[model samples]
Target: SCCPGWSATARSQLTATSASQVQAILLPQPP
Candidate 1:
């Protein structure tokens, strides 16, 4: 039986992408 190991990698990539996007929009603006 093959386990779904790629899901972990995908999740990590998704998290990184989400974090970067959030920072790009929310962290670069001047207060």
Candidate 2:
């Protein structure tokens, strides 16, 4: 399990990936 801070990091990464759009193609989406 992750801590509360992990959510912030995940959100940031999500934002970055969403902006780049290529990350989803490079990596498989987690389930």
Candidate 3:
């Protein structure tokens, strides 16, 4: 499940930054 503000964060970050950065945030590497 995504975080509560995931959508908002995504929208803001997506426009403010690059899609690559957003993708990295959305699909994080497993530790």
Candidate 4:
């Protein structure tokens, strides 16, 4: 249940354009 909900939320927020934006934001990190 928790995984389903979390995945749904993440998928919603990570739409195509937003996903790229998020990847860009994370790409410069030390990890």
Index of the highest-lDDT prediction: 1
Better of 1 and 3 by lDDT: 1
Give lDDT for model 2: 0.83
lDDT tens readout by residue for model 2, 1-31: 4599999999999999787777667776898
Ranking by TM-score: 1, 2, 4, 3
What C-alpha RMSD separates each model from the true structure? 3.9, 8.3, 9.8, 6.6
Worst 10 residues of 2 by lDDT: 19-28
Best by TM-score: 1
**Number of clashes in every candidate structure?**
0, 0, 0, 0
Question: Which lDDT value does model 3 have at 1?
Answer: 38
Q: Which ten residues in a row have the lowest lDDT in candidate 4?
A: 22-31
What C-alpha lDDT, on a 0 to 100 scale, does residue 15 get in candidate 1? 100
Q: Give the TM-score of candidate 1.
A: 0.70
Give candidate 1 misplaced runs (Cα > 4 Å). 1-3, 29-31
lDDT of 4 by residue, 1-31 (tens): 6586898787787786787888789885575
What is the TM-score of each predicted model, taking all chains together? 0.70, 0.55, 0.38, 0.39
Pairs with backbone N, CA or C atoms under 3 Å apart (clashes), candidate 3: none
Better of 1 and 4 by lDDT: 1
Clashing pairs in 4: none
**In model 2, how large is the Cα lDDT of residue 15?**
90
